[model samples]
Target: MNITRRALLAGTAALPLVASAQTASGVGRRTMNHVKDHITRLVDQHRDGVAPIVSLGDPVLRQPADPFDGQVDDKLLAEFIELMQRTMRAAPGVGLAAPQIGVPVRIAVLEDPATVSDEVAEARHRYPLEFFAAINPDYRPNGHKRRGFYEGCLSMPGYTGVVNRPYSVHATYTDPTGHPHHKTFTGWQARIVQHETDHLRGTVYVDKLEPRSLSTTENYLDNWNDPIPTRAAQALRFHLD
Candidate 1:
């Protein structure tokens, strides 16, 4: 989303500014440098418009990450930046994490695909995406209220599921640089966060869906554009006794 110049300036000015020296541990330094190089490559790739993809078999994609230790330098930070950009770009997605790419690091990036502001005419740019980073994240529903909708996953590929999610959420996490951040989200943003966090826990979207909600990929695509069926229909189904 085009944050008006005023909004962008205000947001930047509000950020906490803290710079720390990079620490030296032989193995850690090597790892950090490697990650940094990856980030550089990914950024260049993004500029060239080639999307990156992280598959389901990667080690990083399978494990949950530990909390950040705050010793990352430019190099380590760069690796994470590249992973985030590549995964999101390749999936034509708005969010992804290190665990999704075979790295066990506690990191993820997300952006809302619909970020247009009122001042910008929707007809001119109806869908504006904004990127966000989350390291060692924790997310949960803010209340008992929920909404049911269809969700898709990059690792799961052609699969989609109908699942219930909270209408809003409050999440906390560190940034690639080990800085703490918090935010609240609603609608699709909340759904994406909840979905990705499940991946961090080694769960897929299918695990969270009811049997009736499961659909073959072809059927899913066909019905994906249809409005959600009414709640009454969901409640009225009968099965063989």
Candidate 2:
């Protein structure tokens, strides 16, 4: 495939593909610099890697927030929307939130790259595997009614967790344009939505742990589900309580 000069230029859409190519080829100074730029932009706008809107132990993170109350305009929210997309696309992230990037607004985006099944393929022909976003959202899970999956978060960076989540969920939120919307999610998609939503409420994956499931970066990403059999330990830890 031709790497068009346009594609080579640094920006959102092309940067991801180019970075992937560079890594597959070989690591060099220039390629490394491009990777850094892509990762930095995705991590946070702040130089110090802290978000401005929600801080640790903020009450706002706990209380459910109202949908964008029709006051914030589309033009004004455009940057946050763009940041959300850049955040999710440039990294291994399946979803992202404004607070994690230091923007306090109730905004986030998600992408489910999984393939559709044969049963859903016909439906997908009409509605393919696409990206979605939720603004100032609320969700309900039927009492930990889903399978446990490995999860990672941008805020926690490098560290990941194996947490239990509802296999399915339903949520309501506004689009970037202030339009109210609702949808149901299941499987990996359900997990991503719940993970990012927690960010809006000032919580992290660490909070969803069961004590015995918690592990350091090395342990979680490496040993993973094959973790040394230690059933007596707490599965997870909550950063706050």
lDDT of 1 by residue, 18-78 (tens): 2232333355555555554555555555554543455556655555543344435667466
The digit string of per-residue lDDT tens for model 2 on 1-241 reads 0011121122100011244565577643344454244334544453333223233455545543323433234554565466567645554355677665544446678775544355442322212236777877778984556565445555444344456677778888777765778788776666677887877676777788655555555555345433222322333433211
What are the runs in model 1 whose C-alpha is more than 4 Å off?
1-54, 57-60, 70-72, 115-129, 231-241
| Candidate 1: clashing residue pairs, number | 8
Location of the lowest summed lDDT over 10 successive residues in candidate 1: 8-17
Q: Tell me the TM-score of model 2.
A: 0.60
Q: Residue 99 in model 1: shift from native, Å?
A: 1.5
The whole-model lDDT of each prediction reads 0.55, 0.52
Per-model TM against the reference: 0.66, 0.60
